[model samples]
Target: MTRLVGYTRQLAPELGPAADVEALTTAGAVRVFVDDETADPRRRPALTDCLAFLQPGDVLVVPSAVHLSHAVTHFATTVTALETRGVAFRSLTEPAFCTGDEHAVDPAQVLAAVEGLRRRLVSLRTRAGMASAAAAGKRPGRPTVMTPEKVAMAVELRNLDRPITHIARVLGVSANSVQRALAPLPRHPDSTS
Candidate 1:
């Protein structure tokens, strides 16, 4: 009999017991290896052990597709290795990989998977950009805090050997605020300030 393994980045508070219960109730017909408290299956040592535990034609089931990384090369390599071993994949929440014939264990499925991965990468980039903007004291989806005049003054003050504290005090802001405001100014880039 083939096995079904579920991989997750740490079991959910609400779903942890339920997942174990469901796996245990599988009646010993399909050995279910439930790896708990993992970051990513790719990084988990248990995943290597689980892969070794798998026989040809075994299946790995995940709850959602996004649990897998959004890196196309990474995802593709993983899927290819599993396919080479005749180990199938299933996402319970996404019937495409679980039930759809065209999507189930087919090379064409890579396109859809790649597209999904691309979308995920885009979203991750967007979130990272927003976070960096916030750290720089700029609000996301808003006009920049440093106007042209502000940047010019920042460069002028910085060149004048004025300490960041003094500049910020004069500018009516924090030292960090001044640093951030002046960060965009060319730092000797192309010999320009």
Candidate 2:
């Protein structure tokens, strides 16, 4: 017997993704799993449970292909593993990727390849821009949040035994940022390490 198991990480707290759940139910999902790990989707316990609950002959249905993995590039590898375990995949959005349909070849593979190509093109363009910036003696990527003046102030504040959190609040930055800035600061000879 083929069972459809749907999974989703995007949850609307107010209504709790009622529409997505209803759509999965309407699409014949025997069980629908929600991954509520907002801080880190990769560490979703529900996603792990969903995968563990799946068995051979079950179809893993998703609202979209993006729900399958943290990144589009990982979807192909994940779906390939599912296929290896005798499970199939279906997407509510991308109907072409549905397996067990009358098609000469698996469209999922093609879709995955196409997405990979798109990502590669983006990465190449970004790298080329960064290289050009480097050649012109301009640093690429995000500008430094902390400067020499900020570091000097941070060091002076630390010398006064000010807490990192307090200093961060004053500087309008995170404690972690402040900590990183002060990581290499040589302790005052009179202060305890």
Candidate 3:
């Protein structure tokens, strides 16, 4: 008997109106694995569970190829792993990848197509996000933690011959932060001598 299993990383509100499990059930999935409150692809416990529950001849179905993986390499690796385990894959959104279909399509070809599509989609989304951030006058990286005052204090403490650890302790910051804060200071000529 063939088992149809589904997996998803997102939950209720983020998954939108139709629940993922319900949608998977509608798509003929008998069992579903959902990772609750997990956003990181690397930390999907439910995905691991689904993989563990899989048996030979079972089919793993997902709404989209992205649900399997966001990265092309990781997607390919996952597909290969499934293939090796005798488990087939099907993407409801990308019907070409469906192994259960009557049409005989090369899995490699499907993988390539999905990879190209994922790359384009990721690139488009990234560009859109960057453009939005630029429009909002916001920088793309983490906000600076070392303020000018902190830097000045670090420099002052360094000049006073305070150790990096002591300075960090006094300022409630890391020793690495103290070191980074003092890195740009002009060296005293006497100190260099």
Candidate 4:
């Protein structure tokens, strides 16, 4: 007989929907491995326990594909490892990709979906990190070396038809910096007068 095993990353039971647990329970999942208090997958003790407890006919059930992994390569590797151990994978939210079921879905399609989800998750995490940094008054990327005084001097020299190399030498700044500052500023409609 195939044993049902559940897994989750959240610590608190309230954090996960009751419906998800109910679904797993209905699917005959008797054991659950939860990685509470750790965001790092490398430090998940409960997951280790689940892995050690897994039998050849056991099926690992998860609430969603993201719950299994947010990384495409990791997800694929984990699934393949389980398959090699004679264990199956099932996601309540993604029933079509359940290996425990008799329905045969293309492995390539599942990999494509995993890759798409991984890309979207990575993009969202990057955007959130940038927004958080901005909120903390931190600027992203390299700091500008050009000062307003230097920019003004470059602009004046350029307006006087000075050669870019000559302007750069006089200002003691790079030719690239001089050229960038000398670029024409956009005129506002109100400043047309």
Candidate 5:
């Protein structure tokens, strides 16, 4: 008998069983692995065990395709491994991912999947690059207009009893910006006397 091994996971976006066990059992899952903790391969023991337990010719039935893996890269890698191992995939929700020679999925859905993967990969690379730049003491976003020179000029103009609006007009900044830059300066020692 071909084993219909089932797997389920739920961690975020409201906790509870994310996959339907009764549906998997009805779908012919002799053994079902339930992981309530994490999708991280090293952390989730049940998922590791489930992957190890699966054999050739066995069908891995999942309630949804999301239960397969967490990240987009990991999801694709997992699917590729399953395909290489001759283990067919069966999704109760998304049937388009099935290895069976079934004539059902829209061509647009396939294109969307490829596009989504490409986008995710690009996003990951961008994030990594940004982080690398940050670690090297480089800020990623728009440079701030509040330079030390501007703050110093505001302080000197304020000491000379210049109007905040006049100082702001000279600095090409808002009066509020001038006020903010001057707010944190040390108070005059004689003013407290």
Candidate 6:
């Protein structure tokens, strides 16, 4: 019997949604291992488990190619190891390809298609949200603690040779805040005091 293992990090939300579906569709057993470990690459518990359970002809399904490696070198090493074992892999949401066989679908191609579609959808949604915000007259970015008029007044006071400590006291804000607000503009000559 062909065994299909769907593995994903526990923290990855994408894995959770598709896990049940993969198990239902596949005839073989499915094993999920949380790959969250802060240790030497060889000492990772999940990696150890995957190696132990893996056999020739087993198909490992992951959420994304990136989930397999923390870095390019690590990914390459992982691919090599899996290849040596004759274990194949397929990604659910990323470049959809099955490993093995002469005419296998290129994983990179699938990944690129998935990524491009995702980016376009996200961009459209972001633009729509920004437009709605603008229509509502809600200022974008973080909420400002001080109004622009107050900021202008603060700048004017700083130009009149008031000490930062004194300006902060008048503005009812911290000296640190005064410094932050004026960071982009040139400092007033009178501010030396």
Per-residue lDDT of candidate 1, residues 108-143 (tens digit) = 675675577578667755865777698899878856
- Rank the models by lDDT, top first: 2, 3, 5, 4, 6, 1
Native-vs-model 5 lDDT?
Answer: 0.74
The C-alpha lDDT values of all candidates are 0.60, 0.76, 0.75, 0.73, 0.74, 0.63
- Pitting candidate 4 against candidate 6, the one with the higher TM-score is 4
Q: List CA RMSD, all candidates.
A: 11.2, 13.8, 12.2, 7.0, 6.9, 12.2
How do the residues 1-193 of candidate 6 rate in per-residue lDDT, one tens digit apiece? 5677765543232335355445424534476655652334335677568767888988776665544554445555776688789887766554444466743666688576546545544554466567669879987677765678768977898888877788889989888878888777787765675
Model 2 regions more than 4 Å off: 11-16, 37-39, 101-109, 112-193
4 against 5, candidate with superior lDDT? 5
Winning model by TM-score: 4
Task: List the candidate 3 regions with Cα displacement exceeding 4 Å.
Answer: 11-14, 100-103, 106-112, 120-193
- List where candidate 4 sits over 4 angstroms from the true fold: 11-19, 127-193
TM-score on alpha carbons, each prediction:
0.48, 0.53, 0.57, 0.59, 0.54, 0.48
User: Per-residue CA lDDT of candidate 4, range 1-193, in tens?
Assistant: 8899998765232455465667777877997776753356446677778878898999999877766674767777888899899999988767655785585888787777666667755864576567768889999777766689887776666666678899899989788877777566542334321
Task: Mark the regions of model 6 whose C-alpha exceeds 4 Å error after superposition.
Answer: 11-29, 37-43, 106-193
Better of 3 and 6 by lDDT: 3
Worst 10 residues of 3 by lDDT: 9-18
Off by over 4 Å in 5: 38-42, 103-107, 113-193
Q: In model 1, where do residues sit more than 4 Å from their true spots?
A: 10-42, 98-110, 125-193
Cand. 2 TM to true fold: 0.53
Cα lDDT tens digits for candidate 3, 58-134: 99988777666747777778878898888988887777666643548878887777776687558745865776698
Q: What would the per-residue lDDT of candidate 5 be over residues 144-187, giving only the tens digit for each residue?
A: 66699999888777777788899999999988888888888974
